[model samples]
Target chain A: GQQVMQIPQYQHVQEGEDFTTYCNSSTTLSNIQWYKQRPGGHPVFLIQLVKSGEVKKQKRLTFQFGEAKKNSSLHITATQTTDVGTYFCAEGGSWGKLQFGAGTQVVVTP
Target chain B: GAGVSQTPSNKVTEKGKYVELRCDPISGHTALYWYRQSLGQGPEFLIYFQGTGAADDSGLPNDRFFAVRPEGSVSTLKIQRTERGDSAVYLCASRIQGASTGELFFGEGSRLTVL
Candidate 1:
C-alpha cells in the first residue's frame, strides 16, 4: 500500500516567522496536490504539482515537488492569522482518488 | 452546480445506531469520493465513484460502511452499528475526471458525533 507521511504534525509560530511542512510518499506519485483546511471547514485545494522538481507559488506560499516525485513541501513566508489551518498533501491515484497524508496543523500566533 | 454540497452539517447519534450522510457534487462532474477525518487529521479515503458505479472502494475500513451512487450525481454513505469511534467529519469531493489537473471541489463536511 502507498502512504504519504507529513512531518511536524503540529507547529506554532510567531506571526512574522516562516513555516514549512514536508510530505513524503512511500511510492512514486503521478501527481501531488496541496490543500488547506481552515478551522471548522472542509479541505480546500490550494495547488497541484505534476512535474519532477516542480515549483509553484501563490503569494507568500511556495510549493515544491521532489525530482523523484515521491515527496513535496509547502512553505509559508511570514505567517499570518489567516494562515492558521491544517495543511495536507494528497497523492493522486486512479479514478480521481487521492490518498492524503496525516497533515500538519499550523497555528500562527500574533 | 456551484460546488459540492452536503446535508445535515452535524449529527449526533447513540452507539449501535445506523446513520446516513448525503452528498451532492458539482453538476456535470463524473467522479465523486468520500473521506473521513478525525480531529486534527487529514481526510482518509473511503470510496470513489466513477459515474453510477464505485470505481474504487478499497479504503473502506470495514463491511459496516457502505456507499451508493445510483444516479451518478448524488451519493450517500451509510454506516451500521456505529460506534463511538465513528465520530468524525465525513467529507465529499468531486472532480471533472479521474486524472485531471484541476483541483477537487469539496463540500462542507458532515460531522458525526456518536454518543
Candidate 2:
C-alpha cells in the first residue's frame, strides 16, 4: 500500500507573500501529480512530475520532484487571493488509481 | 459531454437507505475512476474502470458498495444499507486509455449526506 503525506495541513499567507507545500511518500513514487481545489469546487489538475529531480513552473508556481523520487514540493510566489485553495499531491497507481495526499489548505488574505 | 458528469450533485438520505450515484465520463475516454472526499480531506480512491469492466476495485470499503460500467461509457455506484459514515463527496474522473500518466478530468461530484 502506497501512502502520500503532505505537510502544513493549513497555510495562511498575506498577499504578495511566498509559501511552499511539501509532499512525501512512504514508498518510492513513479510519478507525482499536483492538483488544486478551490472553495466549493472539484480538484483540478495542476501539473505532473515524472522524471527524478525534475522541476516545472506555471507562472507564479513552481513544482519540484526530489532526486530520490520520494517527495515533491509546490512553491507559490507572490501569492494572491486566487491562490487560496487546497493543494494535493497524488501518486498514480495501476489501472489509473490515484493515492492522494491529505492536501495543504492555503488561505491567502488580500 | 466535454467533462465528467455526475448526477444529483447533492443527496440527503436516511442511514438505512440505498443510493445510487451515476457518472458519465468524457466521451471516448476508456478509463474511469471513483473517489470519495470527506470535508477537509483529499479524494480517496474507490474504484476504477478500464472500459466495460472494473480493473481495480480494491479501494472499495465493503461489499455494500458496488459499481458497474455496462457499456464502457457510463458508470453507476450503488451503496446498499448506507450508514452515516457513507456521507461524503463522491467524485468521478476520466482519462483516455494508455495515457496512464495523463491528468484526470473530474466532475463536480455528488455530495451525499446520510441522516
Candidate 3:
C-alpha cells in the first residue's frame, strides 16, 4: 500500500504569520497535486508539480517538489483569515487515481 | 451543467438499508472519479472511470460498494447493507482524460449519514 505522510496535522496561525506543510511519499511519483478544501466544502485543485526540484508560486502560496519527486511542500506567507482550510497533497497515479495525504488543517485567526 | 452535479447532496439512511449515490460529471470530461472523505481526513479514492469503463476500482472497500458508468457521463455508487461506518462524504470529480497535470474539478459532494 502506497502512503503519503504529511506533517503537522493541525496548524493554528495568527494573521501575518507564516505556515508550511510537508508531504513525503513512500514510492516515487510521476507528479503531485495540491488541493484546498474550505470547511464544509469540497476539495479544489490548487496546483500540480511534475518536474523534479520544481517550484511554483501563486501569489502568497509557494509549492515545491523534491529533486526525487518523492516529496513536496506548501508554504503560505503572511497568512490571512481567508487561508483557513485543509491542504492536501496527492500523488497522481495511472488511471486518474490520486493517493491523498491525510491533509494539514490550517486555522488562521485575526 | 457548469460543473459536476450530485443528487440529493445529503442522504440520511438507517443501518442495513440500501443506498445509491449519483454523480454527473462535467460535460466533455472523459475521466470521472469517486472518493470518500471521513471526518478530518482527505479524500480516499474509491473508483475511477475512463470513459464508459472502470479503468480502476481497486480502491473500493468491499463487495458492498459498487459503482457503474454505463454511458461514460453519469455514474452511480451503490451501497448494500450500509453501516454506521459508511457515513462519509462521497465526492465526485472530473478531469480531462486524466492528463499528466492531474487537475480535477470536483463536485460539492454527497454527505451520507447512516444512523
Candidate 4:
C-alpha cells in the first residue's frame, strides 16, 4: 500500500513571504503530481515530476522530485493572496491509480 | 463536452437509503475515475475505469459501494445503505487514455450528505 504525507497541515503567512510544502510517501512512486484546491473548488493539477531529482518551474512556483522518488516539494517564491489554497501532492504508482496526500493548507494575507 | 460534468451537485439522504452520483467525462477521453473527498481532507480514489471495464477498484471502501460505466463515457457511483460517514464530495475525472498527460480534467463534484 502506498501512502503520502504532507507537512505543515496549516500555514498563515504574509503576502510577500515564501512558502513551501513537503510530501513524502511510504512507497516509491512512478510520478508525483501537485494540485491546488481553492475554496469551494475541486483540486486543479498544477505540475507533474517524473524523473528522480528533477526540478521544474512554473513562473514563481518551483517543484522538485527527490532522488529516490519517495518525496517531493512545492515552493512559491513570493506568495500572494491568489496563492491561498490547499496544496496537494498525488502519488501515481504502477497501478495507474493515484493516491493523494492530505494536503497543506496555505493562507496568505495582505 | 468542454470539460467534465457532474450532476446533482449536492445530495441529501437518510441513513439506509441509496444514492447515485453521475459523472460525464470529457469527450474522447477513454479513462474515467471516481473519488471521494471528506471534509477537510484530500480526495480518495474510489475506482478507475479504462473504457468500459474497471481497471482498478482497490480504492473502493467497501462492498456497499459500486460503480458502473456501461457507455464508456458517463459513469454512475451507487452507494447502498448510506451512513453518516458516507457523507463526502464525490469527484469525477477523466484522462485521455487512463495514462499519461491531459492533467485529468475534473468536475465540480457532487457533495453528498447522509443523515
Off by over 4 Å in 4: B98-102
Ranking by DockQ: 3, 2, 1, 4
Arrange candidates, best lDDT first.
2, 3, 1, 4
- Highest lDDT scorer: 2
2 or 4, greater by lDDT:
2
Recovery fraction of native interface contacts for candidate 1 = 0.83
Tens-digit per-residue lDDT, B14-34, candidate 4:
999999999999999888889
Against the native complex, each candidate's DockQ, computed on alpha carbons, is: 0.81, 0.83, 0.91, 0.67
Question: Model 2's CAPRI class?
Answer: high
Sort the predicted structures by TM-score, highest score first: 2, 3, 4, 1
Candidate 1 on A1-110: residue-level lDDT in tens?
33899999999989989989999987788999999999988899999999999999999999999999999999999999999999999998777678888889899889
Q: What digit string (tens of lDDT, one per residue) describes model 2 on residues B2-102? A: 88999989999999999999999999999999999999889999999988999899889999999999999999999999999999999999999887367
Docking class of 1: high
lDDT of each: 0.91, 0.94, 0.93, 0.89
**Residue A28 of candidate 3: its Cα lDDT?**
84
Clashing pairs in 3: none
Candidate 3 docks at the CAPRI level of high
lDDT of 1 by residue, B1-115 (tens): 5989998899999999999999999999898999999887788889999899998999898999999999999999999999999999999999888445858889999999999
Clashing pairs in 1: none
RMSD of 3: 1.1
